[model samples]
Target chain A: MTLPILQLRAVGKSYGTVRVLKGVDLDVKRGEIVSLIGPSGSGKTTLLRCINFLEAYDEGEVWIKGQLLGYHSKGRTPQDRDSEAVIAEVRRPVSMVFQQFNLWPHMTVLGNVAAPLVLAKKINKTEAHRLAGLALERVGLAAKVDAYPAQLSGGQQQRVGIARALAIEPEVMLLDEPTSALDPELVEEVLSVIRELAHEGMTMVMVTHEMSFAAKISDHVVFMEAGRIVEAGPPARLFGKSATPRIQQFLKPWLDRSLSI
Target chain B: MNVSPEHIELLWRYINAMLVTLGVSLLAAFIGMAIGFLLNVLRICYPRQLSIPYRLLVWLIRGTPYFSQLMIVYFGLPVIGLTLSATQATVASLALYSSVYFAEIFRSGWNSIAPGHLEAAQAFGINRWQSLRHIEMPQALIFALPLLGNQTVLVIKESAVASVITLPELTMTTGEIVSATYDYVGPYALLILCYWLLAQTIALAVRGCATLLTSPQRTL
Candidate 1:
């Protein structure tokens, strides 16, 4: 069995007694595309942030490629480790693409992509520009390298965001509803990029509402509701006969519309 | 009906003197901006230690009157064994005054930086320093430029105070020529016109820079 690139064992989080995620266990193996399907406020985004340690987990262990991220005990005071050390490791190994496409407005598309390599990795400018060009080309945004983020459309900006992530050469890519902010016409452009990455066997965890795309692209589908995973299986099993009543109820209206159309 | 040629010569001499004072004001403004830039970098990079001292300095400068401060340096410093020439004292006082305004200019610019950009920089693994250099400082300066330009104009107008120390600056020369020639209207009116013209030019330059520096709107 391939060792999982990322594993969260009993990860839990809360904001002043309002529990956001509880006993959330997930394992994402190398080269696997995992789709996390959940309704709004179901802890999907929180879980993704937890993997990168952006949101502190109140309880449990987050292990990345067999390195224990941290061990938090039940009802124990949190120890303050230097976030910079963990941040360097986390930033090196993983990159997250946000829903809103948080591209730096002041930077050009090439500058945005080249920033992480130069700023974080200390890559030289010439090499950084080269890698940035490669990343932009991979996202079909080679022509927009010199364009500022403000000059790009929503889909183009999101693709630039993806390019920025790819420029870092991370092992795992965490996408928190990457295309949800795009218009329907623009969604396909972003999804196609994601689909190509999936085909290349890049490890990815996606929180998405795109049922058909999830069914088509995900190796495993984990259905979550109210801060817990309600079902987990291969996409075929989950979307076909074995889809639980909750998922069925959730997808019924949309599924019926598609069938009628 | 005839005015002394000496008085006419004084007017010419005063115009040259006024030019020097204008140059000094420009130099002070530039130095104050540089110091403010350093202070802003320190505030962002090392906020805990530097902010207190920065606040204290700005407070002391702004709390006192600029003219009195000039007097303190030119007249009072001699008793403290740190005697400076009248021109030097005027420049130092103007720089001190401008720096207070400059620091405030920087603080406003610093606050204007969007937190999202900073977080994005942090997430990219750029340490604090790199983020400020690559992201924050450039962006903040865009917001800072107009206020600094306004302060520059204010510094030029306030250079009139330097004439009190008998520095032979524009305003003082105008006063001397007016007293001797008994024609307050021409010299003083001309001085006002010159100051207004300079202030307007600074304002125009600020407007031009503001247009150049406004970032394009982001779709994301």
Candidate 2:
């Protein structure tokens, strides 16, 4: 019985006056596939961003592998930000895949994947390139290593995005609506790559709308509304006759769409 | 001989003047870009520290005419206990005058990038400096090359303003030669041709560099 790899305690974030996440608590153990599903503006994406300290939650604490993130300690103000070196060390194990693919347009596929390793991990160029090549090959993009992001299709670019994240060898991957920017046909290709990572016991916290995929792959499905987690449990509990009205109501549209398909 | 002695001296003067103009333009362009890029970064990243001062400077510079600015640096600055030579004033004033436009170009370039691009970099523990260097700046530069290139070429033409200070650049040399030799058809026509060719060369060089930047593999 080891501790969870990620722990969120009363995590809250606000943009000036409007609060986006409130008292959100989540625990993700090693190799856990946690899927956050909700309607738009539910703070699920915000929650995912908070986990990586990308948005910098204003209140409470985010614990990655038992080390506090964002502030110096729990229940601290945003002003009590940690030093960059400390923040860097704390979040070193985290990597992200963005909704927009977010591949650096100036870099080729291989260069895009190799940059973070050299930049973040301080790996030598030769070693970083080798690791990046392997990551690309894992995502099945070896043929397009020299191609620029603009030259690749959306699916291939997202795969490169995945490869870049994977190259850093993070303990947990934060995916913010990974397929939301893709065409319907392209979504499956990205999903398949994500699905492969999930099956390989790669720990991931995904913000997704693929209800059937979630139902099939997720160990735990969290239903969020407004700025809080309304309900969360294993897939059977959340998806199968949800006890919470909000969870059922949220899943109803997605369920119907999936069922009809 | 292919050319007469008097004609050779005139040609030599023209070449020297063209060199001065080219030197001033290139130096000013690069210095202005470096200042603009640093100012843009400071304002964006530390708005509280830099915003008001930078805004005041930019407003003052952008609001004034380049000729007056050149005069102020060359003439009026001596009143402020900071005298500068004609060439120094030309380079300094042109650099300052164009810095505002270059800053605006850099600002647009930075904004043109999606937030996700920075976020992706940030999440992987790529610090602010690393993210800007590896991910943000290059893309912003590619976005800004055409506009930045335009401004650089414009500086060549704008250096004509320096002639008023008797800096002996192309335009000043043309005036001097035309007055001495009474040959408007030769030096005047040559002045126009000199500027035309200089601007064209810079514009072509910038386009070639942009193509290389945007598509490096093909160039390789």
CA lDDT scores, all candidates in order: 0.83, 0.89
In model 1, the Cα lDDT at residue A253 comes to: 73
Every prediction: chain A TM-score: 0.95, 0.97
Give the number of the best model, judged by DockQ.
2
- What is every candidate's C-alpha DockQ against the true complex, given to 2 decimals? 0.29, 0.51
Please, what is the TM-score per model?
0.86, 0.91
For candidate 2, the docking band is medium
Residue B114, candidate 2: Cα error in Å is 2.4
Displacement of the residue B173 alpha carbon in candidate 1, Å? 3.1
State the displacement of the C-alpha of residue B113, model 2, in Å, after optimal TM-score superposition: 2.9
Tens-place lDDT per residue, model 1, B1-220, is 5789976876578668768767989988988888877777787678898889988998889999898999898989999899999888988888878887898899898898878677667667778777877788777887788789989988998888998888877788788778888998887888887788788888898888776665433211
Interface RMSD of 2: 3.3
**What DockQ does model 2 achieve?**
0.51
